[model samples]
Target: MKQAIYYAQLTKKANEYLSCLYDIAQTLVSFDDYDDAKMYLVKISQYKITDHVIKEKAMQDLINVQRILTGLEDRYEKEDDLQKKMSLAEKCADTYSCLDRNERSKYYYLKQLKHAQELNLNEDQMATIYSSLGSIYQDLKEWQLSIDYFRREMSCRIGLGIQADIE
Candidate 1:
């Protein structure tokens, strides 16, 4: 009980720091400083904030950063530095990857499909990935995969006997 309280307090503090970092990044974006904005976004992501609200906010911030990154990538026409261009592209993809494709999240279901094929995400990671997939499928009225992924997640949660506020 005491440990849980301590953990919660720590998470709250980290969340506050993340919020500050996000503001700095937003300011950089407003100034057309894409590199600095991306750097700050990555830094904020390193802050450990397990509180559901904070984590959700952080994920949303990542999605926003991804959009900005996309615009930046498009604006840069020079391709003299192949490695740098590749690195920037990868970072842009990674930014989108941070956002789960839930209803609240701004990601498309196709992102999860591409992710599952590209990365062999494990059960916990898969749960997050597949849940997002499930939600999108549900929205599109595609019942088969939606039911399959949802049941897979439910089975895993039941096996772990973990209390999940999935709904």
Candidate 2:
């Protein structure tokens, strides 16, 4: 039965398989079996997903499960070159932020900020990091910390002769 289902999925009737997946995910999520749902999405990501509802979700979950959460993070930890490390940190932070995982977002942003400071990157780069940190803090509801970071961003802008405005 499982082999037949697998063969059907790989053949010309792939869309039939694709359309059922989102329903399966919904049922799994309702049952709080989120891990299994995510795996199903990942498994079907190889196909051209025409199902609008599941396409975006499946791709995001695929990257989140396969790369950003695991591969990129592991690479970040093992990476030695400061520039490459900073790049990975920024990518991880941005991806996590987009995924609404703000805690992990904040962590990677701080990692990027630390590397930026250690390398004595230019004011513009520092300002961007400060701004990103500020936004993360705002999302996290750490008002005081957010204000401090915005202030740092302002200072960076002023030092760079750019008119600074804080929202």
Candidate 3:
């Protein structure tokens, strides 16, 4: 009987912690404060009341949020270095893509592609951007746009005297 009561108490506490963690996650998104959210996630993940699964899930969410925040922060911080800025922008786009935020991914990818063009990056760099855009459009099921971007990528590779090898 004592063991059953103890288990019940533990379960109740775990449920409460899980609810609190979820509430915090929603609040973080609403507030758009990644730094604080990261800290909060870390703290929540450490709560002994929650089970391993909940803890792991919280950690994964922290990683995703951190990646997005870092990409956005780094992209703006390296304004003078167009290459670095583009790289960070690409990371941001990829992170959003992984999170299933295709609209944001497309927006950031297009923005970076424009920046790359304005800066007159090398063919290889431009080709890479075109490839990324092509893949993104393909994922979004915009078939015509995807084909056009892929063709642009092929043109870029051809200009650089390289053969496209199914990439």
Instruction: Report, for every candidate in turn, its global Cα lDDT versus the true structure.
Output: 0.54, 0.76, 0.73
Q: Which candidate is the best by lDDT?
A: 2
Collision pairs in model 3? none
lDDT of 1 by residue, 1-167 (tens): 23443554576576655566666666665665657766767765665544466556655665666675567346323444544443444444344434322332323334444444355445675566556656656765679868876876675556542224344
Per-residue C-alpha lDDT of model 3 across residues 1-167, encoded as one tens digit per residue: 23443554576777655656545664664566767667767877777767777677677767778886766656555577777777777877877675556777898899789788878887788889989899999999999899888887887788843234344
Q: Rank the candidates by TM-score, best first.
A: 2, 3, 1
**Prediction RMSDs, each to the true structure:** 13.0, 6.6, 7.0
What TM value does model 2 have? 0.66
Name the TM-score of candidate 1.
0.32
Give the poorly placed runs of model 3, Cα more than 4 Å off: 1-61, 69-78, 160-167
Residue 19 CA displacement from its true place in model 1, Å:
28
User: 62-97 in candidate 2: lDDT tens per residue?
Assistant: 566445535788899999999999999999898777
Clash tally for model 1: 0
Sort the candidates on lDDT, descending order.
2, 3, 1
**Cα-lDDT of candidate 3:** 0.73
Question: In model 1, which regions exceed 4 Å deviation?
Answer: 1-69, 72-119, 160-167
How many residue pairs clash (N, CA or C atoms closer than 3 angstroms) in each of the candidate models, in the order given? Answer: 0, 0, 0
Better of 2 and 3 by lDDT: 2
